[model samples]
Target: MQPTSELVFAQLKSKNSNTRCFDCDTKESDWCSVSHGIFLCLKCAGKHRGFGVHISFVKSVTMDTWQFKHLQMMKAGGNEELHEFFDFYELGNYAPEDKYRTKAAYYYREMIKTVSEGRVLDREKPSIDEGKIIVEEQKRVMPQKVIEKAAEKDPQNIKALIGDAFEYTKDLGRNIKEKVSDVSIADVENKAKEAFSKIESKVDSWNFKEKFNSVKTKTEGVYNKIAAKAKKAMKKITEEQDFDDSKLVEGEDELMLDPQGKNGKK
Candidate 1:
């Protein structure tokens, strides 16, 4: 196969309608015809094709050296060898053993590795940082309007939270409904007993009365409607059944004729 630089030169040369690589077509005009075949012009030939490396002894060059300069700055900060390697690249100079090029590639690999690790570590523990951020946010004092404004600015977050809450409640309801539909009356009573025990534990142990009261106050209107329905249901059930243990334990009183009655009257 042709060398990478030769391939690039051929590709660029094919850019011109009037020009074609000895083996292919190109439309670019910056290619020069050498003895054996077409070659890249001085500028294109010296610079790396799409950021690989530079070829020495091409003539005039046009590729920006800013990235190389920035690399130099980084080397100045702490990478001494980086500076030397970059100098080698910038001047189109290479050692006989490819030492400069190898060192530069090594440093580039390390930088790439460092960046990759940073990204992986960042995503792996986002929630830890996020928790700290949320805590700081909670500590910050702002007007209610400001809080609402912030939420409005990030409407996607608000929408996402609302969607999450809706999905959670919907899933919960579906699960409970499915369980209720499949259970016998006895199972319903057992589950209700378990739920009551859990509620009692919460009521007895949880000390957030202020928080509970605030929520209760906000939901008082809905609570009133529910309470009314519950009272009506309780009243209906009580009317159909007697709660007197005496009536059940000692059957209902009966009046009989003198044959069996204590008062011997007809």
Candidate 2:
């Protein structure tokens, strides 16, 4: 991670698309999101961090230590590849509620749709304009680091996915049976099987396990800080209650605080 940062910065600089921020195209870009595999300027980087690391993992190209896998993801997609996949009407279409930036929307909805289909990422594809052929130049070669969920080994997660698929299948089977009162049990079973197969396929296809882990860890940290502050507030309230009885109540103060009389014959 230490010396690898230097290598990452050098690789990113080699591309023209990496020259500017992928989000705002701002000059002097220095930050990036490892999750989405896009470079970002300083300000947009803050927004990505705010989105939570699970959705977007922001890191400095020069300041932060780098991992080899992180660099590979960045190469898989930068401004050029993302633009080609998204086909943005506006160059910097970032907003406060950037659905396009969310992990589900980006990794699953749009980009995944393209990948799942027969079509490739369209990186080297040519776009025709006025009958003039134009081919997008390949800036840098990307690694074959596949996108997958890191949670495949967790049995609980696997069970949850299968459970969800079953629930959906049940609903579909019921609907089919209702539409045709004479529909046989075998027909309904077939429908359920198809439904389960499609659902299971989607689950297996979009495995985003480790990316979410990074976000989950940071989210837990934020909650832990809040819990600590809540405990401090409770302690202060307890102290305040003690002060109230000591200063305001005459007979009740000893019973509430010490609960013993020093002058008593014990």
Candidate 3:
């Protein structure tokens, strides 16, 4: 039997996490991406709309009516699960390299197909107190007296520390690029390394090399797989052009590159 609109609304309300926008972290979600089974704020929903229906099938949570199929898609995915997938795949990092989202389409297809097949796509995170997560975030950026106090007592949070450190560099790069027309790669890299080094000096337990090596391994594995698929997609309609090699006698001292077909007859 098909579910009614009221039941879908009830399901949406039952999950407390559904109240938060998955993308912007807004307090209230007025829209949803039915394709991904994640809630969105009005602002984020508009952004998703720009991504095209192939990326996100968005609709209003309160205003738009829902069908049974939509509910099934919603059940297959949720905010946190998709968040894990996004973080694991490092989709944000791909945005710069993938302006056309040609490779990104493969990831979306794989994730959705896996989810619809009822298979897990990401590693499950161990349960942590919600307050601690909030405090860890605040401690990185807010610089409040209370947050600093909390951080002094809390065990080292490596993920948050490194993630924020990278985030700072990303923001710095964007700001610098906007102001300066031409910025060299070395300058940005040096500045980012300097910033990250300062943060790493403070964290005693974070083995950045080990973590980076693991990331490098995972990234290469995924990249090689996708590259194989992409290699097969190229379409060639033209036959090979055979160039004349008669212009060169055996053991020619110099090869002429002039357009004139008459050799030495200019």
Residue 89 lDDT (model 2): 28
lDDT of all predictions? 0.29, 0.46, 0.48
Candidate 3 regions exceeding 4 Å error are 92-110, 113-266
TM-scores across all candidates? 0.16, 0.39, 0.39
Off by over 4 Å in 1: 1-154, 166-220, 238-266
Worst 10 residues of 2 by lDDT: 240-249
Q: Write the residue-wise lDDT of candidate 1 on 17-44 in tens digits.
A: 3242222223332332211122343223
Report how far off residue 256 is in candidate 1 (Å).
62
**Model 1: how far residue 53 lies from native, Å:** 72
Worst 10 residues of 1 by lDDT: 248-257
RMSD per candidate (Å) reads: 33.9, 23.9, 21.9
175-220, model 3: which lDDT tens digit per residue? 4322122333345445545655666566554344444333333323
For model 2, how does the per-residue alpha-carbon lDDT over 1-266 read when each residue is reduced to its tens digit? Answer: 33366666687688888889877777756777776667787667655655544456667676555666666666555768766654432323435345444333344233433543435565333232211222232322111121122334443454454345435533553243222223333454455445545544544333433433332333233223323333443344432111111111232111111112232222
